[model samples]
Target: MTHAFYVYASYGFAALVTIVVTVWTWADGRARRRELAALEAAGIRRRSARPKDSLGDGE
Candidate 1:
């Protein structure tokens, strides 16, 4: 009901949101890494491993 209460509540909500987002991002990254490792174990190669064009063109 008071101004201080509202301010503290807003800060608490923001902190909670930040923590949730950080944890989600970290977990997603770990999952992706595991998937990539599994693919590599199956002999899948990345696109960057391909040979580049002799010319300076983007194609």
Candidate 2:
């Protein structure tokens, strides 16, 4: 194979990998957001929503 063929193949492979990762991340994020929304709708609250203790020590 020619040097040009190898270079183009590598570039194409990299691009394909990047696209796959980006799409996977986007879809995962959407799924997580939907799950969170459903949980909230079911009346579940995050830990951060609760009031903290006055003491500086960690509880």
Candidate 3:
């Protein structure tokens, strides 16, 4: 009822998954920041466009 191979396999799989996730997260964060900076430099704010008030009563 021993499980030496199972323990080793589980550890190896965990390590592989951790490495992949870390690399993917780092790349995505860097790319996102770079894109935001470029947009700001071009005077383009994506979230600044909001709708105006709709109570048409002649202000």
TM-score of every model? 0.81, 0.83, 0.67
| Candidate 1: tens digits of C-alpha lDDT, residues 1-59 | 89999999999999999999999999999999999999889999677766676335665
Clashing pairs counted in every model: 0, 0, 0
User: What RMSD does each model have against the real structure?
Assistant: 3.3, 2.7, 5.3
Clashing pairs in 1: none
lDDT of each: 0.90, 0.91, 0.85
User: Compared to the true structure, candidate 3 yields what TM-score?
Assistant: 0.67
lDDT of 1 at 42: 100
TM-score-based ranking, best first? 2, 1, 3
Error at 46, model 1, angstroms:
0.8
Clashes of 3: 0
Candidate 3: how large is its RMSD?
Answer: 5.3
lDDT of 1 at 22: 100
- Order by lDDT, highest first: 2, 1, 3
- Evaluated at residue 56, the lDDT of candidate 1 is 50
Error of 1 at 48 (Å): 1.1
Q: Write the per-residue lDDT of candidate 2 for residues 1-59, one digit (tens) a residue.
A: 99999999999999999999999999999999999999999999787776577445675
Measured by TM-score, how close is model 2 to the native structure? 0.83
